[model samples]
Target: MSEAPFNLVYLGIGTVAWGVAGLKIRAWRRDPSPGLLVVALTIAAPATAFLVAAPVLYRLIDRVAHRGNLATLLVYLGITGFSAAAVVLARMWTPPKERGDAQVWDGATADTWHEVRRRLAVFAVLVPVMTVLFFTGGATAPETPLTFDTTFATVPQIALFLVLYQALFGFALVDISRVCFGHASRLPTGPLRSGIRLIVLGGLIACGYVLCKLIAIGAAFAEVTGTEWLSTALGPGFAALGAVLITAGFAGPAASAWARRRRDYQALRPLWDLVYRADRRLALEAPPSAWTERLAFRDLEWRTARRGLEIRDGQLTLRPWADPEVVTAAALVARRAGLDDEDRAALIVAAALRGAAAALNEGTAPRPREDQVPLPGLDAGPADERAHLVRVARYLYAPLTGEALTAAATTTG
Candidate 1:
């Protein structure tokens, strides 16, 4: 088959693939926002334009079809202008939101705006240069040009512009992937992330293809002998490679999402396990109450010199004048006829453990350190202080149920 026909076939396949991928991305995200749809359309629009235009443009160049330049330029202007407009509209329609707030739909808007601005800026610079070059009769040349300068001044500039345009478009696609797959909290925690990474990789490969195109253009411009082979071979080869990578990148995430929706958890279990393990590690080691554990009795001493409570032998001590409420609770528990001091101590330990565990589980605030010494009159005696310490310790070690820790006397007794 001729290169034109072959390219046409490739273009058709690419368009179909991109369309399917866009639909899949939409379904996977479960987002029907108009702004998101516009962004998605914008991402695929450049690729679609290039794919459709490639074969026709190649044929026009081969046949020296300068008559088509007007139409071609118009198409380029339309695509580029629409792309810029889509970006601007998407930005205006979607504002940035705080990160990790799942309720926010426009979390990625800022990044999207940055990416769009960059791509528009590139096109803004290149389009005028291209228009000037096209109007100056650069698109038409003999099969073998009379001189290097004639071909060099014309063909390569056009090629360079296409190369830069494709690269900028690819970069924008990568930005879209970053937003949809990277930070999308609604996405299932599995292949979606991997798929986004693959998309980014594919975008990089597309960028590489454009780089190769630039190199080819430079070689053509320099009139390097036999370099035509490089230009011809690299251009189609890189484009094909980029297409394949992008297809895979787009397909992987979509398939993964579908699998998750089908309730095929086992298929995505490994990825979920990794996330679960990471979250578990973060929670266990840094349970917010860890801050309270760091506050020592000495820290309290430094803040206030309440003579009633002191740290001695790693235990909190209370003076004899501590409040009766505190002393009575411990004394009542101590007086239980059937219970020895050891049994009373055991109850205190269980109560403390239960209280701390409950607090941790319930997400309650850590017990305040003795440093915040309740108003002076509220100060309990040594026994009362011991009771209070037990209660506080319980609050810390295990969460206390309100019912279990009713009036300090209940636990002490």
Candidate 2:
């Protein structure tokens, strides 16, 4: 295999890891919690590992250190740190059992953290031990960046070092996969569940990398030949692919949430603008401008939520002007057009709101009606309400909606 692909894969994984880590850092700044910081560091650890493992950088690093394989020790340390961080993340992510006993819950949480700390302490001890073994094993002088494991597998010290490192790394991979699978099974289907599944899969593949290296080392110790390919090709390949999957796993849920927020923010614009024109006071914050508001991504969740509330406020304000007959007319038109129940309802609401806004703008005296056009999602939660509003906005300017509003206005006028 060409080193180009390996280098590219490693660099790509590193880039993704840093991106995820940056997001976590941003979140940590908002919440400033320890667990959030740990999550960021957890991702950064493997990111550093892969960057160091890139063939060109690997050789460059070792050469710079004036040690033949110093990059190997650095890479191992990064992986060990990642292993410990993964364990921490797994513990932190698992929800506390729903026991009513507060003390029991506290004790359980404490015990879990204690176990996590104990395991991490063990990894800490192993890091220095592995470094000692690497130097003492006489495996550091040959500059075998890509083939270090297989090349020195026959050396007793090097073999022992490899075994101990792989043991710790493999244990972490298996433990995390098991825990994540259990937690993921209980989660409803969504980006979070999907992300956890990807992590589990990545951990399993990383386990393969550890297993392959250990087997190759064992084969070499037994004076077996022709197994170098396992450590050099298959093992590294598994490690690279696993790293990519794990990075994606961390990024998937975050990216999904960001996309949803952006979509909702953009989708609600037309309805927001219409209501804002009717009553400028509907907007609590003087958004810099319409163009800047569209371009703004900072505090997006807050802005989207504020926009939703403003829309709801506008709907309530304009309800007195709404012609209930518009709702009836639009419903009939939508039914005749064979629109689905959801779209039909949305079109009806859109027509009512549009006519109401027009009435308010036209200086038509607001008259109290016994029956008002009911707004969609009045009793729904914020998310469901926003979703329905987005649908209503989509049909706000539709021909059927316009026709219904015209028919109602003509009759009412």
Candidate 3:
């Protein structure tokens, strides 16, 4: 009884399988959507159960009880749970009125009477079929748990078990296909959309298992019988690969959103830096270095909001020196360059900011004109302000804008 080296393959699968369970747990805690709950349970429960029971299923069967337990727990429960999850997803996204008469899904989704009865029929068939194999005596199946051709090759029981198992899988996958397609077709471009696509890809990959199984079943039926490897080897391999892909897909949306925000935060860096350099007093805290900025992934929206605030503050402090002439000159150059209205406004603001900063730096800024009425400072809500600041930032680093600012500084001087 040499201990089989720890199955690294199952170890990897177990990691994803448990992580998915955690997601389901979190979704339940957040919204308590029963449809989502059912989806979580159906996927997470069977996967966890299968992994836990693998050790028992992998060994040679020497008992009268559960001669078909592998078929029951692994094959049957796998179909049952996943099918229920598909139904749940379909109901969640698709409108009730749109769900046709072909399948009736109750508000609870997976528990619809139609689905229940159908699953019960399969269960009813399995109970008798599994019981009929006692006369064959105890069997020694080869390595790689479940679907061993040699274990019950000559027995009618194996054929019935395989048939029921495949039928159940086919039924479940049909609903799963509906959910995946519905999600892919309808969800707008976002993390959720991408996540659904990953699930769809994973489902397709997992379908390979069925294809391999069908090939093996066909070979058995034809009595040519040399392709057991298709079901025993290729089927589970595809299933494992699909599991990994599905897990990744489930996480895709959240991950994508996180990445998107991080990108937006990073994108605003150039402008944020300019505001800090122009008026250090406006900044609530010292700016982080470029390397630190790159690494700062958390609270990005808050940081960006603060950056906008400081940019507005910097403009306020520079207002007494706010030359309408700089705006006028900047506008002329921008218009000649064929800048759009938004770009025109942004470039004018950029030129004004650079001139003010340069004047304070040069220490030769002219005395404020007492008679000229001061233009209003940047007065807007944070969101609108942020948008304008981002625009200004865009032109801040441009060579053309730098030249314009230098020219504007000379004019002001």
Residue-level lDDT for 396 in candidate 1: 25
Tens digit per residue, CA lDDT, model 3, 315-399: 7666555566767777778888998877777787777766666666666464466833243226645546556666777776676
The 10-residue segment with the lowest total lDDT in model 3? 100-109
lDDT of 2 at 148: 85
Candidate 1, residue 75: the lDDT equals 40
Per-residue CA lDDT of model 2 for 261-297, tens digit only, reads 8888888888988888888988976555768856877
Q: Which candidate is the best by TM-score?
A: 2
| TM-score (all chains, Cα) for each model | 0.45, 0.85, 0.63
**Candidate 3: pairs in clash:** none
Clash pairs (backbone) in predicted model 2: none
Q: Every model's Cα RMSD, please? A: 18.5, 4.1, 7.4
RMSD of 3: 7.4
What lDDT would each prediction earn against the true structure?
A: 0.45, 0.81, 0.62
Q: Which should have the higher lDDT, number 1 or number 3?
A: 3
Score candidate 1 by TM-score against the native.
0.45
Per-residue lDDT for 310 in model 2?
93
The total number of steric clashes, by the backbone 3 Å criterion, in model 1 comes to 19
